[model samples]
Target: MNPVRKRRLVITLLILGAVAVATALSIFALQRNMTYLYSPSEVDAGKAPAAHPFRLGGIVKEGSVHRVPDTLTTEFVITDRFQSIPVTYTGILPDLFRVGQSTITTGSMVNGRFVATKVLAKHDATYMPPQVAQAIAKAKEAHRIPKAAQGGGAP
Candidate 1:
């Protein structure tokens, strides 16, 4: 091959190889860390992966909020219309996590209870995060999620 043509072919092959490696690395990194958000109903339906780290969100069931006797730990129930999961957290809970309020707990469920490593509560009396509200709205549209009783009546 002509000298210049040989050099051009080498450079082209090197650039193609670099692109291939980058694509592979991107896929590998993506597969290493993946977590899904679930609602109480989704967890109950076995949609969540067992032993996989995941997050759950729902309203704190009425009368289900309680602090441990002498610890930063607290226990509560997250419920949607279809299901409820008991959550335990060993940290200061957000002030807005009162009965009938919304909160999200991050952890895994073990032996029928949600063992939360961290819990975040909504700050306002009537606030739902936009992403969560959208999920709820979509669920509502599907008519696939049950409507829970709220304020003594069906929501």
Candidate 2:
């Protein structure tokens, strides 16, 4: 091969290799930081990661909020109408956080309860996060399927 052509080919290969490495690193970092959202039903069905931080989205069950005396720690239950998961958070809740409202809590499960690091409540009565809406819809569908099956009919 000619000297100039050989040098050009080597440089091209080096650049491509560097690009590949950078892309791979970027993907790895994203994967590490990625957080998945799950509904109470999905978590009850053992679909959520037990050790990694994830977002749990659902409606706050009616009359489920309880605050510990003289502490920021609060406990509540998040439900998808079909299932519910107990969540414990030790921080100031959002102003909109209330019973029967949509919320998303970021945390990990420990000893069968979700230990939340942050809690997010829906901004308005008419607005819900897309993931939370989808999860609620899915939970409703799942709940209906069982009833239809028991009635000996297709859902």
Candidate 3:
């Protein structure tokens, strides 16, 4: 092979190899960080895998928060009508982290406690997690569907 041609071919192969490695690394990072969104029922039932991280989501159980002294560490319970999962986060709570607010705490279950590294509270009292709102709507509709099937319409 000619010297110039050989050099050019070598550089081209190196560039293509770099691009392939970078693409693989990007995909690996994305897959690693992606986690499942867990409902309260799933957490309570131990349906979540211990190895994978989770997003513990539900309504903040009313009157269930207690802040420890002089620390940002606080404890609260997340509920989904049928069950509740306790969560602990050692950081400043959002202003909306008050009674009856909806939230999604990102972390994993450790020794029975949901160790939340981040706590995202509701935008407002009237605001709720979209999943919570959807669940509520579905519950209301379930009853309506049965009633309508039996009779003329739902009251």
Give the Cα error of residue 135 in candidate 1, in Å: 30
Candidate 1: the clashing residue pairs are: none
Quantify all predictions' global Cα lDDT against the true fold.
Answer: 0.82, 0.88, 0.82
- Quick one: ranking by TM-score, best first? 2, 1, 3
Quote the positional error of residue 37 for candidate 1 in Å: 1.9
- On lDDT, the leading prediction is 2
Give the least accurate 10-residue stretch of model 3, judged by summed lDDT: 146-155
| lDDT by residue (tens digit), candidate 2, 27-115 | 88898356457899888888787768889999999989999999999999999999999999999999989998889999999988999
Whichever of 1 and 3 has more lDDT, that candidate is: 3
Candidate 2, pairs of clashing residues: none
Candidate 2: misplaced stretches above 4 Å? 1-36, 124-155
Output the number of the TM-score-best candidate.
2
Q: Per-residue CA lDDT of candidate 1, range 34-133, in tens?
A: 5446898888888887968789988898888888898988888899868999988898777666887778889998889999998877665457778888
Q: Quote the RMSD, in angstroms, for model 3.
A: 8.8
